[model samples]
Target: MESGKYIIVTGGAGFIGSHTVVSLLESGYSPIIIDDFRNSKKFILDRLEEITGKSIVSFDFDCSNQEKLREVFSTYEVHGIIHFAADKAVGESVLKPLKYYENNLQSLVSMLKISEEFSVTKFVFSSSCTVYGEPDQVPVDENAPIKYTASPYGYTKQVCERICADTAYASDHLRITLLRYFNPIGAHPSGLIGELPLGVPNNLVPFVTQTAIGIRQELTVFGDDYPTTDGTCIRDYIHVCDLADAHVRALESNSDEEVSIYNVGTGVGSTVLEVVNTFEEVNGVKVKHKIGPRREGDAAQVYADNKKITEALHWKAKYTLSDALKHAWNWQKNLDESR
Candidate 1:
């Protein structure tokens, strides 16, 4: 392990990034955070500091700004970088395809350029299971062929992976690992840092907890007519902390290949109704929910085949969906009490 190595976490103040920051710190890496606060907040830094017991080094700037990114590169002697700065909402990406393409691709391009310029060789990309695009097989593996993207959000991840592959192929200097994450939920378990999305929540756990807290009137099960066990979309929900730990393992991996991709998810698939019912039952709160029409572009079932990552990176999800939902509810209650 590269103990005390300086690692730059772009979007480190956001949902998954923040939890990864905690894991990085615990793993003995000095993580310098960079977030624009467009979809995140300054208050998260305080919570992060409280959890890690270290003063965070951060910059409030968009990573796509090449000039500012160059400044950050020159400012810190970075050993590696974990790029997570991208717009991730599927519905929003469908509504604003251009916005998704612009922000997501631009940031990746700038980061790649600056990483090369600064001689930062190791890169861990925050990819998504969306790249698989409603796989024909259950428990999608890393070797699964990339299908046509259902949404602009999925397209961004697909393009970014291609970009990383091409860039790595052209250069022997870069070592890239694309952690294709499934649905990541839950909090730090400290209730300090979690998914603090602005405005209306796009994810299921947040919407569920918010509705339980009375912040939202009711939860809408997006689709109930899909060809699934319960006629709703099924997803592999991995806990955020476990996902963060997987990032740590990815960074620590030693391989001869220039680029590696792993499916970061629990092997279990849970339907929307199951998630809602589990959250309510585990937290002892009834979620007011009504089944709505199936959302456009939603896959019927998509989970992970975790053999590669387990064998290669020595990482596997340790938390169950119920465990994740409990932590999510705990974080939501903390937010409610704080306000």
Candidate 2:
């Protein structure tokens, strides 16, 4: 294991997971990735090696398989774990609720069970702002009560947070940090490995980039009749790298509480129109787009208070919307050339 603190990053090949892996390595930790390539590709490991100039260590298997995960625990003296292995498409989760429940819930349960068995203490969960569920107000803080989830995917995250809390409450060895991420957009600054969704893109930035790159013909604005400044839904879009840094910070911070929760976001809300416009302005590429009906599970407007995470973990988003869009476009261009 190269003689460093080993952290297990489940779903480490996915978009946010891959970026966090980079952050973990840069922060002097050895990240052991456990992924099944169900939603990601094996070539991401090569990309990681290329970006870090270090050999990447990873295993291919579903994390819900307790026996397979146990073998991994037996091989390495695991110090901590960051669980990100789950079906995360909100729209798909709505269409296939059973799939979301079975995969998202079971994988977490398995990870928690293995943690207790192996006595690995620290855990960082990849949570979402969807847990907030159409908050009554903007700039929602960590204390905000989780309201009605707009989709089954959001419900899975909400339930997973509860599962982590209850597990930690019952165990003496675990310290868990739940990071409620707002909209996570953009790619790594390296432009080597970024969001590479299979089939069709789910998130807005990817769809925008794909459209800009001609992989997709036009982007669809989900809703534009909402009561916002631009008559569209709003979100606090944080860069993937900024979000990744928060995971390292959470791992490094010391706290007595069994479970800690923080909101990771840029403390400002931007409308869908604003994001599209900003991308066009920054990349100098016209994204062919048109308005459409509201998506089944979408919150109208949600941002972050971010004071607690700032004061406690000393982490705040440092990337602007323009920077994120530019990086995302650059990543798309890189992907196009590689193809």
| Candidate 1 residue-pair clash tally | 0
Best by lDDT: 2
Model 2 per-residue lDDT tens digits across residues 263-331: 999899999999999999999999999999998767788999999999999998899999999999999
Clashes by residue pair, model 2? none
TM-score of every prediction relative to native: 0.97, 0.97
Which structure among the candidates has the greatest TM-score? 2
Whole-model Cα lDDT of every candidate shown, in order: 0.90, 0.92
